[model samples]
Target: MTNLAKRIIEFVQRPGYMPMKPKTLAKKLGITKKKLAKFEAALEEAKLSGEIRFSEGGRIQPKAARGSHLGIVHRIKSGDAFIILREPKPVGLTDDIFVDRNDLKDAQNGDEVFVKLLQRRRSRGQRCGYVVEVVERATNVFVGTYLEEDESGWVQIDGKDYPDPIWVGDPGAKGVQEGDKVVIEMLRFPTVGQNGEGVLTKVLGSRGEPGVDTQMIIHEFGIPDEFPDDVLNEARLEAENFNENDLTDREDLSEMTVVTIDPKTARDFDDAISLKKIEKGHWLLGVHIADVSHFVQPGTQLDREAETRGTSVYLPTKVIPMLPEIISNGLASLQEGRTRFTMSAFIEFSAEGIPIETRFSRSAIKVTQRFAYEEVMPIIKAKPSEPIEGVSDEIRELLKNMHELAMLLRKRRFAKGSLELDMPEVRLSLDTDGKVTGAFEAEHDESHEIIEEFMLAANIAVAVRLNDEGIGFLRRAHADPAEAKLKAFSEFVTILGFELEKYQSKKHLQALLRSVRGTPQEQAVNYAMLRSLKQAEYSPMEVGHYALAEDQYCHFTSPIRRYPDLHIHRLVSSLVCDNVTYRGASAEDLIRLGHHCSTTERRAERAERELTKIKLLTYFEERVGEKITAVITGVERFGFFCRGVEIPAEGLVHISNIPASESYEFDRQAMALVGRRTGDMIRLGDKVIVEIASVDVDRRELNFKLLTHTASKPPAKKGAAKKSPSRGKKGSKKPNSKQSKPRKKKPSTRKKKSAQKRRKKR
Candidate 1:
């Protein structure tokens, strides 16, 4: 491979070099016939490693040194970005290469770029780079806010992730006004001091219009909001024709008291649970998942579509499904009192939640009831002695048993080092007009835990089964975090009251989380801990999940919304039913599929998060200048961000807003912005009163002003030595040097000691 690499480098350097295929390159290099294959493999590896590059003419050439690195640009904050390099670079240069505002070169979030990495200066701790080229745009289209200043027409992109108002000249702005959101096509990118120019492709409605904000996000993310004609036709046919033969060789569980527990507004109930106390000390807990694979067979249009979508995207008030509504909402959904095909996992547990055994099989089940989490929460919380009126004794007993078992499962899980950070969730209540009437916190109750515990158990059991047989399958893997991140997290927790010596171990991470469970700082610590752990991805390798503290875990529920679960169903079906064999996807194919699905899953999450921000921005637009109490979520050199105690969105508070009487300094070790003059610290988890200063819909952001005024220090006497605020060695905010205060003198320690001795003698 080294020889091949050297040969290719020499070949690309030749005069009049043109890109050519590996076959042609091999022939040009005069390799022997038997060694041609090895040469081609090396050529591919060189391309992947960025030692060689492909040009537009389908030809290969030597890569330009440091001029091109495969990377993705993340517009993480206002007017700033960080490019994550995908292709390997020289040793010691980390993948997280920074890009300043001017260096972005018209790149947006999620865009794949080729960066020109600048020289690293030891003066700056982090390496900052610039984008010389865009290898691929995340999307050519954008939802823009049209602006017409006295007929000088332009469109500003309204992507929530972007903070800058990207103005593009559209000769065809088509008379769109300030409030109208339009779709644009970039014709030319910006250079130096100008905005990019584009062509108006579409014209959405005015901002804050019913359904306009949601549609904007859907368009910005390029979500496939509607099914194609062929896909819809196929889905409708499958929904109309329910073949009796499909249920052949499947067990019928209609007699069981099966019920689905989901949110009140949930449209697709993809999972259901049934519980029965069959023995003196044991209970059979059944988890039934919607059998999507049964309807969307491989090699069909529906299967192809589902694979392409990977997973369904749920916005605040909308949904883009992986499967068509005819299947995901009608046929494949586990509707109450309707017989639907399913794959079931039955686990026998003692009075405790310890699983004695698990059984898997294909089944045709009719759900007896559909209860929302709100309805079930009251039942679960009811005492056995005081059964709720209008609730059946059978249902009450079932709820009680499930809650008990879920508690046991949760206890066992945390005992084994699971990371449980009970972070709050935001739920918005929309009126019939699709407007956000109210926003509130919808917290997790025991009912939610009951379902989560059961689903997790079934998923782990299935993962263990497939992996034990040595079958190649997609496993949810969470790799160990890097050492640098662990060290940083350790330093952070040490300042927040933890012993940092043993923080490197996962057990220490677990212990730290457990120690702060009931404290006021638990949520902030949990958010930090969550940031420290690695993200879970679907892979063909059994790498294990770190957050769950499980060696085996896979997505085995919610097949209606997720593709991996549907694929798992097909694989597990072969083991349970006769005449069924797992030929859905090969191990090699599964590898590719896993990567694609994981990418789509991330895309879906981003869309959902963006929607929440957009909704909050719109909702709070009317409430600007209203004062609210918030917790300090994060602190930096420039400012700190706050999340409202009862609100869902987070906003920033610039350090300049701290009263002029006191100069604020950001302390990296303490994760706080301290008032140097008064010794008042605005640290993580600290409460502060703030007023909504402004809201920018284009950025989907809120800027807050501190309402907690700082008290000024008393005046100093004449001709006394002055005192100044001290600063840290790293990443510290520069303090105000012009302001000073006189120091007060203290009595001598020896004189005070002699006075104390005299008092003692008396």
Candidate 2:
């Protein structure tokens, strides 16, 4: 075989290789126009010799011996799709196989399908395949807006997944008006050449109405909002059965100065804290978490419901509690001056913040005070000589001690190589009608850090104890990232002009992060690093957390919100109070439960993010053409994405929108777009002023037009006399263009003449 044929075979055999057309394949292989004929001749020869094959769409592929593999389809808006394999992937095969839109057949997004791998290869060595059969449908229910055109009813799905309107024979079937937000049950999913058919199942409300967006999201994501009657009844029974005086099998620590510090808007207080200086200058810290297991017993209706929900979903305008509010916000809440049952972790730490001993106990405690995060810092900062009026000396002293220990612990945590990538939280200010008024970055001050440190201590202590007892509990695990990913991140930072000696070394990564601290490249570098790392998830496996730098870690802090914590609480309750080892869920059961909880957690996060974008898009609809300062977060071939520094809304700035005489080419290595003539670079982390071009609320897309570009570092000049386009004036025309003379608009006339000719020919 020739060298070109050998290269083709080798590329096709490589993992993740997708099928591509001849032109695309040549471009990917860097075959210039002069060498295109030879490349095509070699490809044809290879195809004729049975070394490779061509798909029906004329994309080249390798001949696969296997028939089909079960996978889940994820279709993109461009009609192309990738299949995530369910079966054990072949040694040389990728976990996902790319499918061309023509080969996708009738497969929809998220459908489980059987895919037959093609014998061809595409760019980046990605493997390509085609869907053979769809095994299962992900969902038939969809949220959309009702529409009526010439008395024909339709439901326009509110996402890119289904761009076309579904034919819903009669819009008024479910009392849905023309512009009402409704849920449709798909009778027939749409194909490329056909429209979909569905029936109106539910009328949420009129489109753009208050609370309709939230309802749409809830139905769209299939998030359970309403509790079952039995679960609510169980919660009510638990509330009625509760008695504060009955402290059976529980240690009474009501006299201790325990306090709950949370956000001002917090309603469900799950954890409380108490600290005192003890003998030998050791500090005894008590971390009291509401014993939700005490109210939500195992195998009961409440437990079943909570287990299914996995965790509470905190939306911008709503909170979907795992357990009913009767339990989560009432009996389980550690309200100030109220006696609450809790599973407590007591840790004795030296003055230097080294934990010496850890103990667990089932206890009852009355919170001395409920301090908001804003209140704690002020009390901690108050001088002893000048105490704040109406504040007790005991509360003030306790706050001071908590702050000191927490800071010491935080310092030690960083010293031990814990990754600190905490970005300020973007909170939206919503009106009573659920429309976004404004947004602000919530402060993550010392007060928040104090609570965070105590929670980490408690969680680590519990994990250590459980592991020592040989218990099989769901652990919060974060595996180390792949070496390739780290290397990629290292190269990315290097392009941004940061030195990271060893990408694999946690210490080096930490140092690099510290060097970029408070710099212009901080957010970009941090975001890149976060993307390189694996997501933290609940698992029974003993994979340690990479970011926390902990060998043992689990969720044991917020039992009121998290189901895993409740399970951990039960195990601790049995070990501490019953004096018996609780053989929790079996390994298999724990694995399944962990997977479910992790999935629910991700779903909640995605729903929240999507809703926030929707609200932000709605707010920006009125501000179209308004210029705002933004930082480029991502760069791609077509455009770069930027987020407003002040508003935190992200939008895409297409390359076409750049006021340049010459087109821009993507520089993959530099992760930027370079002007062909001007050498101006629009790279990641570059600051740019952009005008809001348009907002597509239905599709949840925000588009921006670049008004100006400021590179983080000045680009090298391609020519001494050439001026960069970055210096162009607002609404500037293309360079050297005849701007004074108005150009004739003859394209539409020509198009009409051509159309008339085509019609006459037909």
Candidate 3:
């Protein structure tokens, strides 16, 4: 064996060595740039010789013995866990093993562990196993609420992973008060028998204060909200050095009639569009994207920070920008009437919206107009003769052409089996105090479609160009859904009175979606289909985007906010401009980068959703006992879950709240609950009135009581009931026991009975 292979094996066999990816292993070994290639070669040779193995996540580890597997633990609230196998599975084993809570040992959520299969199959046909060893811990720090007792303090970690609070010993430690949000560093994890121990590292603030919840979310998700001094200084330097007139080696489209369309609350505009009708029923379209690569050079602090952020996070109250505001909002922002550097895609299209030719250029542009989505449709629908004030003829004609072409492209896209799962975003209206005053679903209209189609076109064009040139770049990939999942979705929709003829066909899925449009079942059906499909993520593989029906697709616009786009801009600029050099990334490097970016993106999304839920829960605290109409989104044996039509807040209606006169049984096949005595049914998509029972903000739980009379048939009348205790044996008459006794009740008993009757009536 080579000396390098020997060194790798020695390092991996160390007592406390954990599995690591090739890049991380190289860094640990202090491999120089000159030896990277030789090191990688030796590592591959080691794997080939059975001295090492690669996990499913591409982490290097020593080959495992039979019956033992390396995997990551995913624990649910019930304490039961599933081990996602990282190594090759043994014969007849499933992809994951189910470990009972008692068999989990010391394994926690997200921990890498070694499992020993029990050689037993679960009732559901899954393999069962037990965790034997924890190989690595995902994290040791956590955010939680600090609770103060008489002389001791405890930290209740957020989420369901740590069900019980960890003991922190002293209440005065870190000056933490009762109910203060704080960060905890775990000294030991909790087990079934003993409480976990931790130390208070930092105190965030008291609960329910302004901006405190946001901070909690930020810390909980480990999101980077603040820029480092070096990063900020680099951004400032770039801003100071930027000169709009320095258009060396760049195409000047400053005179073009380009316009930007975005939300009215938008602070930075990264994309602008222009279109012109050409001879012989052809068209020239220009998609100008802010040239973020021009300022964020490779191996610079700004580039490092942007790459680490991956994408800008859009919280309801604030934004954690990928790049500092100086560059993201100032230098790279394509503001109206301002000259900006951009990477432009010029495409020539036939009248049928088929691309005839495509080219890229580093260019300079001056945006002629900026229109919010709410404003564009009004102008487009206006009569040409009745031109509104400040609406120039050139800008009006450009918008008209844009809408025309976008429709053609959109129609063609759907015809090719693209799925349209564009659910309306529930936008909250907040006051200056960051409290939600109200919320409404944002409309997705033609104005939004115009920009979407253009951006998609540019992305596909760039991806194809890069692929044709044999370059490695990240693609926005969405894998096809598993057949089993699609079949389940088919059964689900069929139970809702919708038919999906062929579950495996995309066209059939599209048809199913179309049939439910504009109906009360639209939201439920869309959400189910979304859950059925895999999430779209960044990868260098040619997996293709399933939803867009595009085989070659990448994110190329909005470089100012998305790192992948900036990377694409750099590659494309190198091809078009003579002054730039392409710093090629290997396929392995792209894969790692893609995984990191995808993780960061998911983290951002989860943080936003979590914070939004907190805000919504806070809003609903003032709304307890209020009645609102809701649609049942999920049904179970324990009752159904529903979301309010107006507020969009979800809460559970426990089966215990059902009328006592009738018993309800869960119908799993039908996705509903049925009252055995009254024959009333409650199923998905059923609209019903519900009253908010309570709100628990700390736990992030909401409860509702189903108004039985409004949701189903009223309880049978007391005297008219078919089944009663007064009925005796066949043909034998018996006096009613209650009437014969004639017993008097206490005043409190009478009032309690009266209250129960009133509750049943509602």
Residues 590-670 of candidate 3: C-alpha lDDT, one tens digit per residue: 886887888788889998988998999999999999999988888888988998899987889989876577787776766
**Ranking 1 against 3 by lDDT, winner:** 3
| Residue pair clashes in candidate 1 | 19-59, 19-60, 20-59
Cα RMSD of all models vs. native, in order, equals 9.4, 14.9, 9.7
- Winner by lDDT between candidate 3 and candidate 2: 3
- Listed in order, each prediction's TM-score against the native is 0.82, 0.83, 0.89
In angstroms, the error of model 2 at 405 is 1.3
Write down the worst ten-residue block by lDDT for model 3. Answer: 734-743
Tens digits of per-residue lDDT for model 1, 401-452: 8888888888999878776667777778888756777778786888899999
Q: How many clashing residue pairs, candidate 1?
A: 3
Candidates ranked, most accurate by lDDT first: 3, 2, 1
The TM-score that candidate 3 achieves is 0.89
Off by over 4 Å in 1: 1-68, 75-81, 87-90, 98-108, 115-122, 125-133, 149-152, 159-175, 244-246, 278-280, 350-352, 381-390, 498-501, 578-581, 709-762
The candidate maximizing lDDT is: 3
Whole-model Cα lDDT of every candidate shown, in order: 0.76, 0.83, 0.84
Instruction: State the lDDT of candidate 2 residue by residue for 1-762, as single tens digits.
Output: 679977877776565566666778888878899998789778866776775665422456665445777678888769899898863476667558999988988789988666887888788778898887655566678998889986778999997898889999954776778888899899888887888998888999886789989998898888999999999988898888999999988899999999889999998999999999999999999999999989988889999889888889989999999989988899999998899999999999998999999988889999998888998887887777885876789988889999999999999998898988856567999989999999988888999999999999999999998999888999999998888888878767766656676777778888888887776667778889999998999999999999999999999999988999999999998888564635578775687688778878888898898888888998999899899999998999989999899999889998888776767877776677877555667787789999999999888889999988887752222231123222236664322111111122346778999999999999
lDDT of 1: 0.76
Candidate 2 segments exceeding 4 Å error: 1-67, 86-89, 579-582, 714-762
Clashing pairs in model 3?
none
